[model samples]
Target: MDLNRVVIVGASLAGLRAAETLRNEGFDGEVVVVGAEPHRPYDRPPLSKKLLAGEWEPDRIHLRQPDTFDDLDVEWRFGVAGAGLDPSAGILHLTNGTDITYDGCIIATGAACRRLPEQSRYSHVHEVRTLDDAMRLRAEIADGGRHVVVIGAGFIGLEVAATARQLGNDVTVLEGAPAPLIRGLGEEMGAAIGAMHEARGVTLRCGVQVDRLHDDGVLLAGEDGAEGELIEADIVVVGIGVVPATAWLGDSGLQLRDGVVCDETLNALDVDGSVVPGVYAAGDVLRWPNPLFAEEMRVEHWTNAAEQGAAAAKNLLAAAGRGAGAPEAYAPVPFFWSDQFDIRIQFLGRASADDAVEVVLGSTQPNEDGTVKFLALYRTGDRVHGALGVNAPRWVMKMRGQLMEQASWHDALAHAATLA
Candidate 1:
């Protein structure tokens, strides 16, 4: 296989990292990156925290320095989206009416924010997916007197609520589930998060159905048909979830479920289960089977994206006969962190709803200073599945290492007990 040219779609964190990896691995081919967003690759995590809080400027969120591309000798096609893909011909069509032929391609298009149903009519409705989104929402609450209504109790929703509260706004969070983040962190941990928000003056309206979003506010009704209340607010931010940015590949003949389906090697697969040669995917847009967990999953986190990007690039090189050995599988222990009020929540590894959960250290109960710290471990029988820590960064970091090593449930529990 000859590697003359390489095209990377979606100039995101994953795409940027992939490009860097290709060059570092001695691939002197023509590397081109295509991005829909005009801005250079930036960090998305701070968009909700420091960026929204006005603590960091937009330029500060960039993943690399401004002259990074020049140093890497890469060409960037910014502000133009990928329209279609002709894999058989090794050609990529862009929205700007330009097409490029490539010997290898990396699909790192990422994901887009899931918008609320019928939210277009309301001008105050917002989402925090991009830098523009954070800027707009930050401007709305700049005066700090607005009544902010955040729909959903997930990480994004809760982070917005916390930031709004910090700005002196009245915040109310609405969640359809009985507790916040029930699906992600389970009921016990979700309730703990809900209580933390309530203690910080944010209203928690859980298990309620939102009827509609009006210009004035949100109309909500109880799930059991009980009469509901109209919560008035000056702004509403929806943080429900996100969908993969795979719409452009609708006719690309690639497999798609919730994301671009791939094998363990991060190679995009066709509908017939055959590999789409020279094409690969990473980041939130990728759905691959994780060998460590023995389950197929799509991890939408920074750590996974960075690790997968490098892995995908190496595999691309392997396919081109540049790699030293066979392509390696991407198997990473997923990790994520969130900042709400004064608490820093971090989780390591994966866990299902049926996994057994136990609080191993500290307590979720607020102390006299309103600070909460704790460590909880999740297990299935004798195998450790996951671990969560609030305001315990050191312990969480240690636990992350243990999770990476696949520590047994009994040993992890004993180690956590010692920490407690």
Candidate 2:
């Protein structure tokens, strides 16, 4: 197949890596990078941590330096969002009324922050999904004397609450679920993590339903939209969750469930459940079957995005017969880390709430230094399926190999017994 121009629909972490991989993998075609943001790609993890806390400036988070952009030999369409797509016509339509026809396309558009209805009406309400969003929220909380009400008790929400409390602000976190992260880490672990906030002087409210934002703060949803208690706040940050960026592909005929569905090879599937040739996807926007875990997953972690982007690019090249080796399956052990207060939490693998969880090492309580140190393993059937560690980097990371090899549940527990 003759490859000429390849268009990348996102100028994100995944998209940036894809462009780099294409040039490194001997794809000399014209590479065009599309970005909805005018600024260059930057790391997002720090947006909620150091950046929001005013410890790190915007420039420190850039994924690459200035001169590195010129080295890629690619055309960048900044400040232009993908408005539509016609996969059959090999065309990507931008919001600026411009269209580009490409030989191949990589969709790494990522996801959008989900907000409550009429969220944009209030000046105090904000969510951090981009550098601009973080900057705005940072300025609001920089003084740190006012009450900071954070809606949702997820990772982002809790991180922001911790940062706010650290800055001498009165912080309150509200969760609609019975417990924070109950869907991901189970009720017991979720409540365990939630306790960290309460210990640090942050008000943690779970099982609270949010009706809407008022001038005072978050209004609790009452019976049939009746009046309810208003949680007053000087500043409000909403971090409920995100939805995959797939509206641009609404008419593109690509299969969009929770995300873009792909095969084991990361090739985008059409609505009819067939691979759409020359179309590849990665990052939070794409979900593909993993032979390792025997399931399909769309990982939102930065590590997965960075790795999958490179894999997708290489796979696309190999599919077009423009690479050195055959197309390899892009299956990875999804991993992500979070820092809240003084505890560092790291999680790996795909674990369900129903999976039997056991603390393999250390206790789930705070250590002598007032920091958490423990490793919890998720077992399903006969296999050790997932692992989560709190302030136990080495012990937690050691489980990666065990997970990759599909180690037996009892054998994994046996290995941990020796560490004690």
Candidate 3:
């Protein structure tokens, strides 16, 4: 297939970067970016942090320079989403009653925030996924007298809780798990995080279930009782999680599990495990095998999306026989960071709940300033699997390189002992 045009669906970080990479890789073919949101690509991390706190304006979160789109030489189809894909015919149907034929297509639609079932019926219910969500949340919580309730204690929810507290509002964090962030960071670290919020005056209800959402508040249930307590809330923020935005591809013949299933090369695969030529996926919408972990995972970090977008672009060129040689497999040592209150939490590599966590430096003990600083190594058997650093950037930076080198558990522990 002669490469004449490449259409990138989803005009966010991944899509924009992929378009820039294609042009850089010497693919002068026509490029098009389609987005459901009317705005151009903007940074998302701030939506939960600075934007939610009202520390930064909406215009400050843009992913690119003001003149970037004008120079990209690509057609922009904003406010219209990709409704369907006819992969066999190499055509993409748009929500605006238009179709685009392409030699290559990159799926970067990303993910949407998961909302509670009762959200639609309540005007005060919100989820922080887009800029508008943050703007509304920030405005709603600006009044210090409002009682803000945050459902879920994940990064986003915790960030919102912190910001709401900063705005002088009474905040309560509801987590069904035994501890905050237990599903992601395990019990020890999750408890440490819970302590941080507690010190900041954010009430945490852990190991409790929210039975239902009322017009004014939520009904809670403890371990033994079905209707336990009612917490009054003027504003409710749901940060349960997100699901991949792949509903449009239901009949597109591509494998869709949690995300768009791709092979090691980031090329979309069919139901038979065969490559679906001319179709690739990147960002949070992509599930590709990482050689480093020997497992297929979809990463939602900002860094992962940038790296995968560029990798997908190169692979797209190579797949079309328009590049120098075979493309490299998309394998990256995953890393992500979160800032809550005064602590900066950084993580590198992967670690499951069963992995052994050994704190090598500082302490998870709360300080006078409601901060906990620590550096921990996560390992299973003799291999170092992951590392977590709280308020310890230098340690995380060094361990990241060590993780990429696949440092042995013994050597990593020895090095970590020095930091202790």
Candidate 4:
């Protein structure tokens, strides 16, 4: 338990939070953060909205102020990535040909945006991921009259489409799935949300095959899966989701399925399913079992990254301190929100085996504030497992607590009755 220096990789939201928690927990030992990007820790959500829309400058999205960041008093090794790891030996290999020995290590490398096959051949293609990617895309879409075709109807793609349309550009969103955001909101609700965008003038093309990218537009697979019609576009943005940033951990001796598999306490697990002490993972690069939901979950939302990063750090320190109680277990309801155009979409909980989403409040129609003022409860058997709210923050917050408590279906209906 002789913990001294703690090394944090990936300088992302999760990594920054972990470092902050280590310092806050009175760990005065050396704290070193190695990041792939040259910039300091910065907020990412606004990259697709404010920054991509050209409404805000690059400096506006920094996660911390200059002086506040300096106050953390940690050695920052930016523009260098973690190349390898040796948890048993407590060594982290960096891409810059340097090895750092630490008493504790936390991996928060996050995820990278996934691109379509052969997408790089086209110079006009873009992605909404890092700050630099957003800046490059902003220049192409800022003029507003360009035809912007977004591949993938996920949050990032939809958000970019909304921003482009609001800036007076023609936007088209193509989703290979039956409905937009089907992975996140299910087909029914996702269709409803997609319709809202369609009503507001963004072209929504669902259940189609993207043959390949042409220099001028996207070519669709025509009849019999051959070359189809051409959707002309001046620019193309690929938001087809992301893959965990686990390339550096390929030979790190940790388990990597879809992401870094972890136990209930967020400690990284080895290939044989044993917790590798003093090593943890957070953000999109982590997958852990959630005792509350009785399901294995991997969340890619901001809230999860922030909470899990701190939780991992606390548990690591607790393990090191050999504290009074066992290392604290991380279990909580997942939550996420997305702002598109004038709508505020918030969701709590997750998709369970049962697809019973009951509309508990309001209508799908836009309210006076230009929001779809509605609340939907995800229930099955006798328990309410999740809830989705559109511009209904109070209801979402209340249900978030209830979902954490594992409220009954009847209780969820009772709450909705109160809203009625």
The number of the candidate with the highest TM-score is 2
| Model 1 residue 392 lDDT score | 94
User: What's model 2's TM-score?
Assistant: 0.98
Residue 274 of model 4, lDDT score: 95
Q: For candidate 1, lDDT tens digit of each residue in 1-420?
A: 788999999999899999999999999889999999989999999888899999899989989897776899999989999999988899999998989999999999999988767877778999999999999999999779889999989998999999999999999999999999886789889899899999889999888788878778888974577657888989999998889999999898999999999999999999888999999999999999999888899988888888888889999999889977989888888999999889899998886889889888888898788799998888877888899889998777778767777889878977776665
Deviation in angstroms for 57 in model 3?
0.6
lDDT of each: 0.90, 0.90, 0.88, 0.89
Q: Give candidate 4 misplaced runs (Cα > 4 Å).
A: 322-324, 367-371
Model 4's C-alpha root-mean-square deviation from the true structure amounts to 1.4
The 10-residue segment of model 4 with minimum total lDDT is 321-330
- Cα deviation in Å at residue 398, candidate 4? 1.3
Off by over 4 Å in 2: 223-225
The TM-score of predicted model 1 comes to 0.97
TM-score of each: 0.97, 0.98, 0.97, 0.97
Report how far residue 200 has shifted in candidate 1, in Å: 0.7
lDDT of 2 by residue, 1-420 (tens): 567999999999999999999999889989999999989999999999999999999999999998999999989989999999898888999999989999899999999999899999999999989999999999988888989999988888888998999988999999988888775677778888998779899998998898889998989987777977899999999999899999889999999999999999899999999999999998999989999999878888899999989988998999899987888888788899988888798998976877999987888788787777889999989999888888889888888888898899988898767656
Which TM-score value belongs to model 3?
0.97
The per-residue C-alpha lDDT of model 4 at residue 200 equals: 88
